[model samples]
Target chain A: MKVSDGGTVLAADVFSSRCPSRSVLDHVTSKWAVLVLAALAVEPLRFSALRRRIDGVSEKMLAQTLRTLEADGFVDRVVTPTTPPQVTYSLTDLGRGLTGHLTGLLGFIQTRLPEIEAARST
Target chain B: MKVSDGGTVLAADVFSSRCPSRSVLDHVTSKWAVLVLAALAVEPLRFSALRRRIDGVSEKMLAQTLRTLEADGFVDRVVTPTTPPQVTYSLTDLGRGLTGHLTGLLGFIQTRLPEIEAARST
Candidate 1:
């Protein structure tokens, strides 16, 4: 994609358009992403704590989601220099802002669960 | 999955747990789902109108999203029986509610676009 302004030509950067932004979208809205955001919204938690908090999530998936979120700067992963190198995860400022949005989305889903279930029955 | 409620043994329905609700989640937070809900929030639009309003979406994907939203009762699809069938799509009360959620999510994404972009560039 290219945009021309006056006499100067500006390349919109197709790599930027189709690569990072799209990838970020996919990560933020992934299945685990929603739940993880919600989980971290309340407070930072340890790896195992997060794994247990979210019901029915596999450890592998959780780790993967956390890594992606970390890469995207939505999650802050801290490693404590402990006996076993205890790692904790928390939301960054931006991540917390994103969590507010996640809360709204999840709240809607939880509140409307009954109605949605009813609709599906028919 | 099995649950015990006092003296009553409840045989938890696995199919129900894994099917409709999950299916609904897949549709509601789907890439197009958020946008479709947001689009309908403004006003009812015809099929082609919606197709055009959303950028970079394929016809097949739009049609699929509309059908899923319709089936889930978030969207009301009206077909006028004329020489040429005129189909319009609008949000149901439930859909509007869902849109409120989507708005928050998308609003966050849009507002954080700059920060997110910067993060990805690194």
Candidate 2:
């Protein structure tokens, strides 16, 4: 993780279209991805529970978003031995670190939703 | 802003497709819109400066994003009555509040670019 060159973090910038952070930004900001991250931030849940918690998310979309999150190192999927083999998904330290702000935004959105709707009407 | 009966925030969940939060989430997470918000969170910038700040955004895209942000109440367009009537774009209070997380996520992505890259290459 030491992407340091003279103490700089390799000059990664999301604003730069060519930068890798740009693509990561795309993944992180995807609507489903954000919802999944926010849900996991509250607590780890099995795939089914997560799908249920995020209303309107199809099984296919949830699986896809989870795979992307897992690839980005923001989520971890674990399987347990059981009668039906339970699978749970949770944010890794990296995911948790990033999700702090996501949850903050979500709360802000929830609080200001009425204002937002008002603005839209006008 | 009080859409509350029992102190509930009207259940405006972004996770629900039918929720107004869904459309709001779409706007917030759009690649260009996110870039615009992140760019503005830094400082108020004119159209040209914003385009420059977010590399590779076409003029049409920038205008469209700005219009959406303005309509969504996340951005304000102020016209300065100078010789040519300069226009500057900045986040509104609502935009600023939500942008806290956007900036946080941007920083996270920038710092962890190397780690994310490593994870992706595998």
Candidate 3:
């Protein structure tokens, strides 16, 4: 979607917020949103697959995160035309951009895991 | 602090946790951590300065966030040996790295504020 000169995308539908950034922060950093983004960062995955990848996320939280991300234009929910319903999720172009940023933060956190542990020991 | 060849930084002191990455994640992604990171991203500031910069943050919450960031080694708490006692905060190299990543996420959210707001309207 093309952003207008004023920075409003497609006339500002339901996804728009007065403080859009705060809303995005709420979603991106929400309880399950970060994990969901990280899980989907690898590849398009089905619901159950996502459940497996994130260490301790519950089904309900997973579903909620997906829904929130979907609404924010950071994720695409694709339903395949098959006998048993098949719904898969992947990052949108916008979503991919977000994933890159979040992953950078996650990567730093991962590498510093030991130091973080050391800091909390006392 | 230099990381050893074994990947343990400075012999893994008090900050160490069983899952250091998870611990860092908890501190970085906590309700107020992100805001604190963002506020400090621009420049080093005193305690009250940060409180004023991040709108809607309470004194108690700000203090708590600072403590958590300091514990994780992401913030440097420099106290001035003055009669009245003065403390200042800034990101460490590690903290700066994390801030860069978090800001990227925050920037994306800020620009997409309109989209997020629009999404929530329904």
Candidate 4:
């Protein structure tokens, strides 16, 4: 099966290791990536703000996740050429499109936390 | 803000490092977990068939993922005590609910693969 993109792309199968979607999914579902996307869904934040929003994330890791998301078209990074050179990050249209699933999954897990914790202990 | 669940649950904030959802999200988004959930989203599969469907997953990792998912209540395990003792895995109702988001995310990525790849290359 083919997925037309300039008539050059094929339909992606997540189960197939050869599919590019597999790798893309990897980036989207990474621990830091998930958290970063969730953080941005509420509002645009500067680099430091994003770092603070997610617990246990290191400076280097947050930077790496942002760079990857920027490249993947899910994040928009803006640089202001000010005296301090301020930088901010927000979700791109593509990122916004993908964020619905993230939010949905998050809500599902959140509301069911009690059940999940109970399941774990048993 | 409060989210009542049995009058014992609290509202969850994913950005809060202390949220239980953080750890649950980690488990749900783990590379192997993502793949396993996607694979099982189709239908129940026996252990060997599931391993074959997901490329690059070893027996050990698959076992671990299944155990975790089972513990989390997103997956149900069925044992058929045949001569060979067959064990099958299927998504529980909870798993089914979460899978809609998974499939949604996967489709978004799959359909937009071209755009994503183009973004990455630039």
Question: Which model scores highest in DockQ?
Answer: 2
Separate DockQ for every predicted complex: 0.30, 0.66, 0.32, 0.64
Ranking by DockQ: 2, 4, 3, 1
Candidate order (lDDT)? 4, 2, 3, 1
Best by lDDT: 4
What is residue B1's positional error in candidate 4, in angstroms? 11
Tens digits of per-residue lDDT, candidate 3, B1-122, equal 23364565553221233444655676798877887888888889999988877777789988999998988888999999998989999998878888988887777766666655565674
- Candidate of highest TM-score: 4
Point out where model 4 deviates above 4 Å.
Answer: A1-9, B1-10
lDDT of 2 at A36: 95
lDDT of 2 by residue, B11-107 (tens): 6677767677778888888879988998899899999999889998999999999999999899999999999999999999989988987888788
Off by over 4 Å in 3: A1-18, B1-18, B115-122
Assess the local accuracy of residue B36 in candidate 1 as a C-alpha lDDT between 0 and 100. Answer: 78
What TM-score, computed on C-alpha atoms, does each candidate reach?
A: 0.80, 0.87, 0.81, 0.91
Residue A2 error, candidate 2, Å: 8.2
Relative to the real complex, the DockQ score for model 1 comes to 0.30
Report the C-alpha lDDT of model 4 over A14-65, residue by residue, as the tens digit. Answer: 7777777888899999879988998899999999998888988999999999
Pick by TM-score: 1 or 3, better one: 3
The native-contact fraction of candidate 2 is: 0.80
lDDT of candidate 4 over B1-122, digit per residue (tens)? 24456778578867677777778888889888988898899989999999999998899999999998999989999999999899999999888887788888888888888888888898
Among all windows of ten consecutive residues in candidate 3 chain A, which has the lowest summed lDDT?
A11-20
Over the stretch A1-122, how does candidate 2's per-residue lDDT look in tens digits? Answer: 33455666557877777777898889988869989999999899999899888998889988999999999899999999998999999999888988987888777887788889988999
